[model samples]
Target: MDLNDLFMSCKKGDVNRVKQLVEQKEVELNVRDRWDSTPLYYACLCGHTNVVRYLLKSGARCEANTFDGERCVYGSLTPEIRNILVKDYV
Candidate 1:
């Protein structure tokens, strides 16, 4: 599927839809938008911890050297989310 559906699902914190999209449709969890933001990035920015967790668990990347990774770490809505990015994705 397209990043639109995957990004919307993550942004809305639709965990089930995210799961279905990633699992059944094989959506790219690390797909970036026009601004170089990923599903994991939006999930972190929007405080969608569950969605972030699922994205990571499903193999979303968190490269510290990338633009989206930097934003995901800095723009994270919660400390726990930052910790997840630091402890798991990085």
Candidate 2:
């Protein structure tokens, strides 16, 4: 699939599709959309814990920022996700 599909999968919390795309299909794990939102950003924003963990393990960058200049950690919708992103960097 394409980057849009990857983003959609993350938003939908489809961790399997995300794994397939990132692992087998070899899609860039950190690609951002027009909004400058990466898959990890969407997963965090949507509160997909599994997706967030999977993306983290898959080496998705936590430093990706939104168009508004908010980091993914700041944009995260849940404390768990925020912890994950922060833990990675710190």
Candidate 3:
């Protein structure tokens, strides 16, 4: 599968697709795109709560930073997503 496929799936909140890519195809959960955005970053940016949860549970890293050195949790994340990442940090 294309590496961008995971990011696209998370951006669209397609949890099943994300799962298939990660579980079946063995895609790296923390793979970053050209912009240095991970699937978790996309999931949070798009407000896909379920996708975010699944990514986290699947060992996605909350501590990942964008190319600009900004934390994914500090990006366009919803409060719920911020909470999830914050809780994981602590």
TM-score versus the correct structure, for each prediction: 0.89, 0.83, 0.84
Model 1 quality (TM-score): 0.89
lDDT of 1 by residue, 1-90 (tens): 577888888889999999998778677776778987788888998999999998888888887777767888999999999998888666
For residues 1-90, write the lDDT of model 3, one tens digit per residue: 688778788999999999998889569988878887788888888999999889889988765354422466776468987887767742
Candidate 2 positional error at 52, Å: 0.8
Model 3 scores what on Cα lDDT?
A: 0.78
Error of 2 at 36 (Å): 1.3
lDDT of each: 0.85, 0.79, 0.78
What tens-digit string does per-residue lDDT give for candidate 2 at 26-62?
6888787887778877998899999989987888765
Q: Tell how far residue 5 is off in model 3, in angstroms.
A: 1.6
lDDT preference between candidates 2 and 3, better one: 2
For model 3, the run of ten residues with the poorest summed lDDT:
63-72
Clashing pairs in 1: none
TM-score of 3: 0.84
Give the distance in Å from residue 54's predicted Cα in candidate 3 to where it truly belongs: 0.5
How well does candidate 3 score on lDDT at residue 19? 90
